[model samples]
Target: MSKMRPSKKELLEGMTPSTVHANEIANVASGELGLEQNDSLTEEEKMRLVCSRFLDIKEDDLMDGDYFFTELDSGKYDEA
Candidate 1:
């Protein structure tokens, strides 16, 4: 007999950052943005939210190629 597979909700609930760095980044991003930890959101999404918050830009404004580190390194969001 075949075993039953987990549902999407179950999978999402069990999901976690694949690496230590990813987890750290997600935690920092969420804390900085005053957001609660959301398991449904990917690491990229969390970082995008951080970038959007700091840059005063919409999350939709960031493209796939855009990264929070790149934006932070660019210093565009630094207060004058």
Candidate 2:
């Protein structure tokens, strides 16, 4: 029997960056942004919220690749 898929809410609620490495945080945020195609409104919203929190930026300003690389190269994470 196939294992049941977790609900979108469950998947989104489970994402967190609290235990990630400093140098790799931005990459994690970038990867989360790529998961935005979940198709469920709740899932997409949760993904954005978690990604924004992970990046330490406002959700309105989250821009995926360019922003993640910029923040990484600018030593922004170093300040945290």
Candidate 3:
């Protein structure tokens, strides 16, 4: 049996880059213009709405004052 050759997509695999070049590539891949710190929640109401939207429950359930909410931190998404 013969060994299979690498596909065209694999040509750039394992290519090493200096710290500066790596960061430059990352910037191009990320189309966003602002820095990491600039991407944040500035408004209080917006923050509450955004956080609340993540809940899988129905919107009507949220209206009930007696409903107890528990924040579940599962998987690496929280860290991301």
Candidate 4:
């Protein structure tokens, strides 16, 4: 079946933050950043390295946290 082309407005609206993030992920997976090959590292380890180095986040700041936040800077994100 032929696919219908999305309208310009629809295409513009579809370029959301998530879609931009996905594109970045795809670029990384495609090795556009000239990442070195490390076959010994597991996927989780590789992700950790990437997040700490490229995302400018410290290793100590990495933690298990909420995926969605109500007020991130107000300290309510970690409230029980």
Which candidate has the top score in lDDT? 2
Rank the models by lDDT, top first.
2, 1, 4, 3
Candidate 2 local lDDT, 1-80, one digit each (tens)? 23476796875574567753547644567557665544345757878877887776577876789878998999988955
Q: RMSD (Cα, Å) of candidate 4? A: 15.1
TM of each candidate vs. truth: 0.24, 0.21, 0.21, 0.23
| Cα-based lDDT at residue 43, candidate 1 | 82
Question: Which digits, one per residue and each the tens of the lDDT, describe model 3 over residues 21-45?
Answer: 6566555534364433345545685
The TM-score obtained by model 2 is 0.21
Q: Any runs in candidate 4 off by more than 4 Å, and if so which?
A: 1-37, 57-80
- Measured with C-alpha atoms, the lDDT of residue 74 in candidate 4 is 65
Name the better of 2 and 3 by lDDT. 2
For model 2, name the residue pairs that clash: none
The runs of at least 3 residues in candidate 2 whose Cα sits more than 4 Å from the true structure, single-residue gaps closed, are 1-61
Global lDDT of each candidate: 0.65, 0.68, 0.55, 0.63
Model 3 segments more than 4 A misplaced: 1-24, 27-38, 43-46, 49-56, 59-80
Q: What TM-score does model 1 achieve against the real structure?
A: 0.24
Clashes of each: 0, 0, 0, 0
Please identify which of the two predictions, 3 or 4, would achieve the higher TM-score against the true structure. 4
